[model samples]
Target chain A: MRNLYLFFRKHYFIFLFLLLEVVSLIFFFRHNKFQNAVMYDWTSAISGRVNNTYNSIAEYLYLRRTNFILGEENAKLHARMPQAIYLADTQIYIRNDTIMQSEYRFINAKVISNTTNRRNNYMMINKGIMHGIEPHMGIIAGDKIVGQVVSVSRHFSWIMSVLHKEVKISAKFLKNNQLVSVEWHGGDYQIGVVKEIPKHLIVSAGDSIITSGNSEIFPEGILVGTIKQVKEHQDENFNTATICFLTDFNGLGYIEVVLDMFKEEKTNLKASFQEL
Target chain B: MTNLVSRNIVRFFFLILFQVLILNHINLGGYTNPYIYVYFILLLPFATPRWLLLILAFIMGLSIDLFSNTPGLNAAATVLMAFFRPFVIRAVSNIPEEELGIQPSMRILGFKWFLSYATILVLIHNFALFYLEIFRFAEFFQTLLRVILSAVFTLGLILLSELMFYGRSKK
Candidate 1:
């Protein structure tokens, strides 16, 4: 009607704003999960490539510090390898050949680009599909779980760093079998919050934290970090503690990507349960 | 005409690139994620059509949401901001409609008036953004804290940017 047109003309901006908001909400609700359409995927790929190019230029800036960490880690691994062989019949799991079959293999790669100062920090590594790196694989620096792989390209992959709010690393007490999760609180890059640790456990400062190995992505017994502080809730049933990570993600350069050979089979089996 | 259109085009591309590539990565602790993109909404020409301004704001914020995986929250907040900007400007500056051809800047509105305008709209944008992202009022206090902190940080950054980038155009 003429009146309807007149009303619309008078308040066109309001109607348009409302209409766009409704469309956005509809798209958001229908997808539920954030949709990574083909365009997004392509952009990520292009961005990763661009990031890798910049990483090469930045690598020379940290050669000295990176070398020191690598030397320390190599020495630690060499010392640990002998003790494991003496204790167990076979120290590690291997697919083939004479190489010691360790449950986890640490493939060294350099970080090309990284962001530690974001709500969701991500790091891009120099090695990727060509180097046998794949998505969902665990990443480590020193003895700590740095993060897990999220996306991969031919020559690069991005890590969802533990500094990110979205990252939830499985952790457990080395002294006891109790399991918990460590999540970043977006407060500090050096610290993360350990959640769901039952209050019944005798926890104290300097308590050791290790990977729970509950996720298919990471093997059991990997080092996470240690509890730096604990705030026990008098009435609440669980203890909220703060953990200090061993590896400085800001100092990231050379890292070891862990490839779990059983990953594909295990993921498929897990998917079967959801399908049923 | 061509020069004006080309200059606007170049500014738009640079603003978006600066937002996503550089400012997006800077997290100055707490819930304060610096949103320099709102500069676009704040700096839009006064003569720009209200509906078109709202649409452009929607696109700018939606593009950020798409890149950052934040769903509809940014778009919703930005459109809300665009909806309220004209009123905020009129209330603060009392510039007659005929003389509104000038763009928003310290020169046209004066430092005191422009600062008030920017602060108010930044608060509105951050309020809608942080609350919508949280999607619930259960943590009303925490959400309020985040909104206030982000607004302050964003205001500081916007003023710093104005000093650095627009310092020469002192009116």
Candidate 2:
């Protein structure tokens, strides 16, 4: 027994080193598999408070640029307002439109912390569960798709940025409405690759890409990016194209979390079909 | 002794904030991400207990991970760096018995000794961090490029901060 004790005492440092490394590796793999919400919440709570305090002071530095972008967005919104439009036909009556019910609600949030250099990047926003944010909700800045909410705490939420390797955004070309998925392959945050494009389709540079709205998360017609180049893929039947993202991910400050009101109903209906 | 403990406590928070707040935002050309937080592990006093060193390194790396939303990437790398630190110091510097407990810094250890020490450890930390982050050998050359570029930038910041902050102090 004493020999065993002496062995441990002699190589205690090695044991400790191995123990710590194992623990950290476990955390890494487990986090990748299924995020431990309890531990994530605890850490995010502390880091969120610090980032909030820092953002308050640092936000003033970008006041001019933020205001400029806000003004442009405001102008775009103002143009769509009912008050700004003048009907040419006097016989046309404007009544309560029941056919066009609001399906998506937008919750404004401030991005407290963000990154673009990492292979799998994430962003933290000021809004959380308290502010009507939930996992799987899409985030957009102005009209550009940003990312999806992966997890939420009481006062903060984590967003898996579109730059993440595993993130695949369902998008379609505006010209032909051909569906393709967009993905980031770990280089150049400003660009993303459009995959699964049919080889026969006529894809040219400068074609606009927008969300397909096939998914419950993001509504249709959200701007994704503009195509920059088309390259033949390894598969003969498909091709891939590179696109320059419209949203300036690096300069993201103010964003809106999209709350799909009928998401639960839609998912439930689909789940029923899958049971067969 | 109390002074050393308190000083490290202050440095712990300061370096974490500086790293996640300022250094993280500096993505020069999308290739270099200078992580200066490893300076905390690098600057730990030579006589620090082995267990304490590992624990401190873990906490520091985890704190950075929390802020960056990377759960364990930094923590694993920093622990590996801490594990290799004593050997790195032994190989680079021939310290006298009287100064065994002295903190590793440019002011005390001289620039050449500190440079090699910081470089090897920073490279180790960055290499582990970037590789684990990608978690694959598919983009080996690209990841290697990022590792080397980031290591050079991190080393520059470490040496610059050491010269600026500790250069004036005689102790």
Candidate 3:
């Protein structure tokens, strides 16, 4: 017991220093910004209250700077959007200049409502008669034709999306001009069937289908989809081709509405011919 | 003993008030921030009990840390100073005669002796405090500069206060 006392007295300061240092280190790392914040919550009430008051004062002082910095960051993000001044004309070129047109004017509109699950699903856009939108306008999103405008209101329009059972758009094989009509199978949004392409055309999976422009609703060569599976029947002369829809109908955000001014004249001529 | 306790009690309030209210706000354009609260730890009675010194240092540091919201920084630094005070006093004073209760000041220990003693300890304390605050040695030179400037300012404040409190020439 005397020896233990001697040893402790001799090294008392060193032991105390180390112990207190460890305590300080515990506090240091516990409240460190890089560490998990929940570790060092054991603080005195008086100090905590004092810190709170100090922090409140500091917070009030820097609030204006914080707001300014946040506003600047937000403005930088907003500037990245396609600006009205940059895309000044109806003939707008987006990233990679994939779309450039004078024959067919493109009006960019936001998709307000959309669905891809039902037998005959439809989509609604935030454009209508007020924005020169009309029925039969082809809606395309980044390389693929999405749908056509079936009804128009004063400020909004509904689209008969290609996922609909009755949708039959004029599509042709990109490899060869083997014309086909695309219709949704109602089971999966990804798969759509192409009709009228002959089995003798040597159709296979991975073949790209594009717009034939036979309907004049969409321009020639607008992307339709890629062939996923070739369903051939011995009795039928035509091949039943399943193609993956290039446009993700479920993720549609903004789409371009194609307005062909010459469509009115073509419709008028067809109407007159029918009258005869 | 009574004089020592009462003096320390008065010094405690004054040092904290000076540190938190006045010195903490003085930002000299990112060049210097004089920490005057450390003066209390420096002037502690030289032959004071080891445990008493550490506890006093801890409380002084804790008070400042509470006000600033840096809970451990000042406490750690002050405790470090308390731990080293005896060794530093022994080294500079070179006199083991008064090992009990000699309050360090320019009046007690001549100007030159006190100058060297305070300068070294203050530098070490500031160095520990600043380095712990950043905890990164990658900016070693940058933090070193801040520590040096802050130490010099603190040292100056300590001397100025001493001159005011303890007369120029001790009778």
Candidate 4:
């Protein structure tokens, strides 16, 4: 007993170092991403303040640029709105009210903090549960899809940005509406991969890609990106290609979340199907 | 004792702010990222208790990690750096063990010694950080190149800061 105590005393420093290292490594190697959970949640209170201050100071510098982008988006929206509408088929009736019939509504929010350099990137936004924000809510910038809300606190939410390695945006070829997925390869923020496209499909370099409505998270026709290059996969039947995003992720300031009213029903139906 | 604690507290916030706000946003050429925050661990007092050093290093790295949203990568890497710090000190500087709180600085360790010390530990820290971040041996050479490049940038920043602040603040 005396010898054991003396030996431990002599090597106490080593033990402490080893203990801390192991704990850190455990968190690193843990299959669950704990750093994005509790510790980060605790910091939301602080970083939200810091990032807000920094962004407000820096916001004035880019007034002209932001105004230009916002003007362009407004012009595009103005041209796209349904200016001519007819009360088609007087006999046909819709159950929901005219204003509330749409399953999704846009919730405007400002990005407080964002990053595009990491293997897996995430963004923080100013909206949260109090603002009707929740996890898995689809986010977009103007007409371009950005990311989805991953976790939400009372006043803040973390967006798993499209540049993140683990994020897979359900997208499709705009030309044919063929279903596909957009995935980040971790090197560049502007480039991502279009997964599960058929080899038979003629995917040219500049072909536009947009979100597929198959995924409950994002609505159909949300502009994802355009193909930059197409390459044949190891399986000759399938094709994978690189896509360049339409929205400049590094320039994110304002974004909107899709508050989908039918998300619960869709998820429940999918779950029921999965049980088979 | 109080002086040392207070000084480190200030340094802690300063380094984190510089790292997240400035160095992180640099994103040179879209590949190499300079991480100067590891300087917190690098400049810790030589005779400081190992347990405290390790915990402090973890907390410091974790703080930066939380802000950057990289999760545990920095915490793991800085912990590893803390584990190797004592040996690195012994191999580089033979300072007496009686000194309780003489923090590392270019003026005390000399420019040449301080440069080597910071370079070696920064290399180790970056190695652990970038590798664990990608977590794949398939891109070994690519990861190695990034590690070296980021280490060089981090070393340059550390040396520049040392030159600017090291001698001016001493009693």
lDDT of 4 by residue, A1-276 (tens): 999999999998788777777877776677234433666567777777787788787789878888998898888888765553355665444455765578789999998888877776788899888998888889999889999888777788889899875688878888898988888877778998888888778889999999888888888899998999999887576899999999889889899999888889988998999999
Candidate 1's docking class is acceptable
Q: Write candidate 4's Cα lDDT for B1-171 as tens digits.
A: 798778878989999999887777677657668998888888777667888888998898888877776656798899888888888887886666554237788886678778888888998898999888878786688778888888988898888988889657563
Candidate numbers, best lDDT first, in rank order:
2, 4, 1, 3
Ranking of candidates on TM-score, top first: 2, 4, 1, 3
Error of 4 at A74 (Å): 2.0
Which one wins by lDDT: 1 or 4? 4
Ranking by DockQ: 2, 4, 1, 3
| Stretches > 4 Å off in candidate 2 | A32-36, A86-98, B94-101, B165-171
Of all native A–B interface contacts, model 4 reproduces a fraction of: 0.52
Expressed as tens digits, the lDDT of each residue in A123-240 for candidate 1 is 7787877898877889987667889887666666677888865678888989996999988865467788898989788889898888888887677877778899998898888888
Classified by CAPRI criteria, candidate 3 counts as incorrect
* lDDT winner, 1 or 3: 1
lDDT of 1 by residue, B1-171 (tens): 465456556766677777766666566553356777888888877777898898888888777764554546678888888999988987887777666544677765567877999999998998888766556565578667767777888888788877676665532
lDDT of 2 by residue, A171-264 (tens): 9999989999999887789989999999899899999999999988899999999999999866478999999999999899999999998998
**Runs in model 3 with CA error above 4 Å?**
A32-276, B99-101, B168-171
Query: What is the C-alpha DockQ of each candidate?
Result: 0.40, 0.71, 0.11, 0.55
TM-scores for the candidates:
0.80, 0.93, 0.48, 0.89
Return the interface RMSD of model 3.
21.6
Model number with the top DockQ:
2
Q: Write the per-residue lDDT of candidate 3 for residues A1-276, one digit (tens) a residue.
A: 999999989999888887777777666565424121222223323433443355456556556755674576568757766662476674444434334335678898866555553335666676767899877789897557999887665566667789764579998999889889998755467888888778678987899999998897898889989999888888987778889988777666668899896788898999999999
